[model samples]
Target: MARNISLNFRVVEGRDLPAKDVSGNSDPYCIVKVDHEVVARTATVWRNLNPFWGEEFTLHLPLDFHHLAFYVLDEDTIGHDDIIGKISLSKETIAAASPRGIDSWLNLSHVDPDEEVQGEIHLDVKLWTEAQGPRLRCHIIEARDLAPRDLSGTSDPFARIFWGSQSLDTVTIKKTRFPHWDEVLELHGEEGPLRVEVWDWDMVGKNDFLGMVEFPPDVLLQCPPSGWFRLLPFASAEEDAGGKLGALRLKVRLAEERILPSVYYQPLIDLLVESVLSPAQDDTVTPLAMLDEVSSGESRQDIATQLVKIFLGRGLAVPLLDYLNLREVSRTNEETKADRSGLAVVGRTHLRQDLDLGVLGYKSSSHVTQGFSKLAWCEQSVGAGPGQVRTSIPVCRICAVERVDENAFQQPHMMQVITKNRDGQLDTMYIQCKNVNELNQWLSAIRKASVCNEGMLPSCHPGAFRGNRWTCCLQQDRTVQGCSRTHSAVTLGDWSDPLDPDTEAQMVYQQLLLGRDKLRKKYIEFSEEKIKLEQEVMKGQSCLEEERSGVPEQERPPTATAAAHLLAVLEDLEQAHKTFEQQEKEQVARGSLHS
Candidate 1:
């Protein structure tokens, strides 16, 4: 038979009138767990802080849970150790609460306190024991005056700041070592995530490191060369060798960029109500190693596997087995929104969450985003065409005559339409609403109002596409990989030479010619600078490869920072040349087939 645990409680300051006569409560309760497995709990009804006014309580459980997993609670909630904290009795500590029985640990019923008696209180839980591993404890050590105190850690970069609400014309600054995470520190988030760091201040002072979340580059072009991606370190653990944890001290101020997704691909589904999203400040967040290999020629599967090994060996990642509660947040909100709790589907839920850009279609060695080619077309004349003249008008009228298939929005009832300029015509966007009311709302909250990319409304009709008007198509911007951006279709137009066999080819030629001069210059400069790096790798390989040949390449491939990266670089350049060759071969086959 299995044994169960019981909790004993007594209020110190707060009234503890025997809430439930649990003299015989036999539910084998656990304080914290990683998942189904309990990691830490009390062996006996051990005394601890009370859930009320810092009283004392005792709980009993099998002691096997002392050092296997951690605890996780809802954003402000805690485990059964307190009145407000609740979980499945076996969840990890992805979300932590203030210390036990503190004033900040309150029930949601008191979200707005009327007076002292009616005041709100926060609940908290405690892990019986902490592991002796290198846990990069990113203690959000400071924030606005509303910032909750009472958070306690063995080490800290704990600092504080205050963002008074609006109408307060003057902003007052406060500095102090927050005593603990004892109080509910988060409030008035529309102001900002009270800035805090989780690193040693001394290191930051040494390097003069004023930082934001060290994110992957925000706006990389699709299929950007691997060499372009590099890590930006906010803090490093090497700076604080004496401490068990490195504090990446963070600072927060209202900035427009904060609201935008770290990358355009990661969209915001929703915020945790009153909870503000503070940036993560960790010395360990700096890329431990870029998993990119020397060659893009290797299959992505092999590359990812190799990179995983490299990242683990280099300390960028612990084994996927190390961390519990490994989750995968998706790119699309619709799919995730349907679930009561979000799920990381597909390979998205790997234990190693933070690695090379796996989320935003930016795998170090993958071309998933650039899998399809990008082409340009023009939007010609408008009005119903032959395709629509005979069928339901839902068909794109303009696309029927001009090139419409390319513009997914050429369908009738398009909510929005954009016509691109060819010979310097003013760009235009037409939007429709069921009624004026919705239109007003859209215009009032039109988040993306302006445009700079004028490439629009071109169709591919052998001849009539550039006639007069254009059409556009619309597609939801939900990315296949858990993203939240939206996508739309457009059409474009340009002059054509009826006598010539090809119109697109001619336009492409002219555009390429016009841009070729600048491109050629840029290419030369890039090559001049790049060759030195490539040469060094080749030089090293010359020495290394000759001496060691029996070893398979993957086992002892070129160094990530040295000759190996050049393989990717050289291959990218070669890929372009190969594409042109493939095109030429296809053209030859067409002529032969016709002949």
Candidate 2:
């Protein structure tokens, strides 16, 4: 199965970048990479310690990619660009964020060459006890896509295998990233885990470490393991810059899956239909229920996804989900109901404080009083002996509230709230808070109050409109669309997305295969009944297939056709399984061969 991920992110700004030029500032830019391949680059900002790009990109990436990286570099006209620092987000880290994703300032870490390695190596290993004693054999097949170590951008790579105090080295393959060195090394009476390390064989100075892989002694107990194992850097202390190198403000979100077209899923769909339509002798002993019972919590989610897709393909998804939800709601106890009611009341009161006529006081250099229904501010007169004048605007008229750049507004902890008056004119309010936390609270409260108002602003400038241009995006027109994505818009449609049945079904099938032996052992006493059930199911499936094959496609009976489809799907699945098994055998044979 093929997997994909859609990544959307914005490189908002960089702060406190180190000086790389003699003029006391760095001309900085960012390069984005998926795995080791560069995907995007931002334009350089000249002569500034702090730079704002406000650049956003949406990329489609393979799910197997190891990491996403941002390398910050300082541009120099005289020599090569200086590497400032880098930020690397691993696949596991990004996936943990899930539906909400990450939005924060990430500190950059200094790069180390020996710690930055990529690629995989193929190996075959076997251990057995002979009349003489115990013996071990390891076949190092080949390595591919190792990191470039030489200045010419290619490494002379070789593998070193270690068992206990003894070690063996393979012949070096020079001047190539992908090296094919087929060699087998044997060890006798060695009683430790096997370790394999790949290195760049440089004649001058010491050989550079590429990557390494290790296998426990227990692995030899199974059939000789053979496959491509990913290379990893030597374990070291965690890299930290302590915010001195600089920080990148980034917003990243991962899209879970990219589904194929409906045609590609027809076979899986047929199998699901057959499972649903087949008659069962026992109501509680259906295939799905049995699978669910044996499945782990994670695998159960995969099964549920498949079932949802199958129902959606048949146009019954909404009704099925609604029925399930209704059942859950009916099962809720009185205590749960009371808890939910209390939460709802709290939510209502929170909104009421924003929409009612309650007066709230905000202290600044000047005394400011605000009412919930309308914002009212009283400015104390300085020379005119404390004369007070009040100005008010309805809270419902507010559309957008966004953080202002401290440099642009020349004030710390400032926010801008935009509103539309009854005359259709735009009004701007600049509010200064005591601190960042207060500014955030006011922004949240104002946004929640006018969330349902008509004609709410879709986007607003994070930077002020000055010198006939927007500061953040440098757009000359003040009315141009906002450069940054808005966070206030909420949609419920994503909760109804259809899942891929093929991936889910494969996961469930693999789990069942793994547990087959245990299941057989558990029901050993019921072998006769199990055999009888299997024979009946196979006989019925064969008869249905033969009956359908004998009839014309147009004249086939509609009542029992699902059985025929199921048989065909089963045949296809069996062929696919055979093909995979054959491929694995071939790989193992190739890995075991000596050059």
Candidate 3:
């Protein structure tokens, strides 16, 4: 499937740039290149060695892009621009960072010695694609003198073709001055400017730029135009500053064109989301791999962050993050064979709990533990206690945790932990912490952990335990086996262990998005109710006014006492309706803020 991804690059700032002009300063601007094609340029920052240009760009490309190049150039009005320095990062290097992406200051390298410029550029790269349809076939036949950019006197050459947002790459020929690649690559998207770039591949550092050619789609509409197209030097500061660069001999031509409808691409998007929600076991063909390859310049975190936002808007953030966390856990498991808990225990404290109606006042709590995977406690007698152990809870089994009023106990730090027991009964445990801070900490931890456990599969069923051993692994009786796992029924929540503020915020954000529609519906229903009740109240007031005006009434009550009672009831209802309307308006405001 054609990958849907974008590269978000920010040319944030520059530092310690050498002077390219006579005034001891150079006006620096950034030019970003994918392969040999210039994709973005920043506005010039004049008269400063340290230039701060917070320029950002978003570009869509095929997964075949080799390297991203950033060139810092000094603008010259009278002639060509001056080269300061350049830095290039490969897709593999960026992909290692993935999802969160990269933000760092890279020491600028790859400067022509004769140009006399040096500096570092602060850049941020993120992988993302918001939201393609035709197959354009191209054949790369051969190339020549792709510049000896390597110190080895020969170049490993490759060719890349770009058409609008889509791109294709030919196989690389090793150690050849004139490499031949008789390969055909097919791209999907609307037709636009067809760009071809030749480059010398390097195992390390920046790849050498050979040359590039551009042809309009009109050039391809004809019979596959085949011939040697002379490669041109990249439009760089070196070229502008009266420096000569070599070119390449290249032969490529369009082969065929097949336009596809929009519906044809829907499956790709569906697969992309599906892959994120439930990643494929095979990493090579996974949607995440495809996305990473296309936006190799972007970090995987960028993609995940984008996916999180998208899912949050769609009210699927909880499920989305859960899947991602599981994928992460599975990947970690594969990499390291060490035996460690998947869920990290977060906090432990001494507290008091409500045991039962049989026990009187609060007793000294033994050990109260809170973790991403579960919660557990031990209790003792009022003095140096008896350390009786209570049942440990799997975090997933928890439904709620709330603050409670300290009445009889008079403990300032009081809260309740609610979970389901083995019998599927609501188990509420009232706990009193040492202080308010401790109470808040435990409350937040329990709440965050519960949210993390939202979509996790039970590690093993509650009934998986047959005496001391788990029967689920035997798989002898399908009716009795509740899950695939044979052990660790409550250990499933380790994937999202050690909850932090960011995770907390995400849960809140998801709730707001989830409640958005409900809030709107609620506001409409309340408004309608209030309007109806007000109308009735107004009609009653109209009837009272008519009776007081001494007008003839239809079937009037015989006594003034009944009329007085009716007016009083109408007044009471009007006041009650006004109060209810005020409360509804306040609720709507809160919903708006949350949303």
Candidate 4:
């Protein structure tokens, strides 16, 4: 089974933050992390004890994640950023919240050094009944991809194995993330679970704890445990202060999933494939039609994901998706003509809108822009004035279009369109939207319209130019280089990544193999009969091939032609695999040389 979580959250604001700068204020920014991986970062709010960000993000993560952390840091241009504090929400705590999700101010807490460990260790263990007593043997083979502890980006790692009160240590490997220690330690009649802890050796003070793994004595006795185990920090109580350090206003929501075995999904996969290969009539019953009738919205999404993977494994995803999308489009056309027509109009308008020259009119622009003008259109040159009929700015003169942080516009949702005016000076217009969705749509549409414009901006400020400094980077000059890279105008693509049929099929096959025992129980009665039939078929094929061996090559049966074609396909597959192996070796060699 596989578990998934859909997370939606906003870093609204921070209050009562401790000052990290000498001027009595800090340039604060928020970094959101899901289980050690940084997912998003908010623009820095310069020189503010209390700052409002109002940035939102949506992330899909594995449900097995340990926690979500929001780290507030003071940005500095000259040195590394200072850590203000963090808010850690564990999986259990988030799940216990209301289904509508958490919407409140969360107090920040100090980070503990012991909670920062990461990486994994590989171990092999076995138990034997000796003349004296039952002896346990531990093989500390190696550890790879260990987290760096030193400033030089490497750690001197060593492992200590404990069985009851007795412990053994391995020789430390210096200045490398990948460490190998092919040493075995023997323990006589250990009474408790075996614990293996990997630590980083320090020349001064005590060694730092990297990560640890444990195996029960019962498990070791039953069957020797041998594999790479993910390292985890020692469990400790989280320390959270009640609004002393600071508090952050946040809203978060999660979605979860549980996947079943592949053997159980085979029937559904077969039906879906059959529907695509031999499409049924519109009125006929099909697997997709039945699923639509029965499954909930969330279930449908999960099922669709699985179906896509299954078809991709079979190298039929494109046709299957086209078949399903065509059916859905027809259904929509039959059900609501008005809504379909409206969507068609919107799409056509977007497609016709030229990048170099186009007109965009919105009613809500009157309050957002400088004047009472409600229309923005391209002109031969910038010509807008106080008495102008409409706000005309040349699309070719547009420099940048970027999201406006809440601190800049003092509004919940806004974006800035920077262009050159009639005076040949940079002019900015802020556009407000009712909601985040509308803001994204308008931003995407405007970006699409002005993508091909010449002299486009390479970077843009995400924060306001206020108080004689850029809010994000604290640059004194108004036209100083942007602190953040500007995003490309191209929209995100569909989720069909490059196909790897072998990998996809292997994943499906592995899932089925994991439940092989259950499959055996279900099909045990037919096993002998199936094997007998297979043997008889193989015998008959061999006899027929022998009889056909004397036939002339030109007079050979169609089976011979089919066999030759299959052989050619096998040869091509072998060649492809060899080419891939060679490429992988070259890449590894290059990486080693670079290191």
> For every model shown, what is its TM-score relative to the native structure?
0.16, 0.45, 0.26, 0.47
Clashes per candidate (backbone, < 3 Å): 72, 0, 11, 0
What's the ranking of the predictions by lDDT, best on top? Answer: 2, 4, 3, 1
Q: Which 10-residue span in candidate 1 carries the lowest summed lDDT?
A: 111-120
Model 3 Cα lDDT, one tens digit per residue, 1-595: 1122346567778777778889988888877666544445678888988888776555434565556778788899997687776776667766666655667766665465322211111111111122345456667766543445544445677888888887777877775445657677666656676777777787898877777777776666643446666566555543322211111111111111121223432343354456556665654234433333333232333334444333433345345545545544565664432522111100000011111210111122231122234555553312234555464667778766654433213344555555776786655566656554345445544654575444332322221223353221223343442322111111111111223323222322233233333332332232323354346547775433433333223333222222322233334434544565677689899999986
lDDT of 1: 0.23
Report the poorest 10 consecutive residues by lDDT, candidate 4. Answer: 492-501
TM-score result, candidate 1: 0.16
Model 3 scores a C-alpha lDDT of 0.47
The TM-score leader among the candidates is 4
lDDT of 3 at 341: 19
Give the 10-residue window scoring lowest on summed lDDT in candidate 3.
343-352
Better of 1 and 4 by TM-score: 4
Error of 4 at 405 (Å): 31
- In order, candidate lDDTs are 0.23, 0.62, 0.47, 0.61
Per-model root-mean-square deviation over C-alphas: 28.8, 22.3, 32.5, 19.0
Please identify model 1 stretches exceeding 4 Å from their true place: 1-551, 554-595
- Candidate 1 positional error at 236, Å: 61
Task: Name the best candidate (by lDDT).
Answer: 2
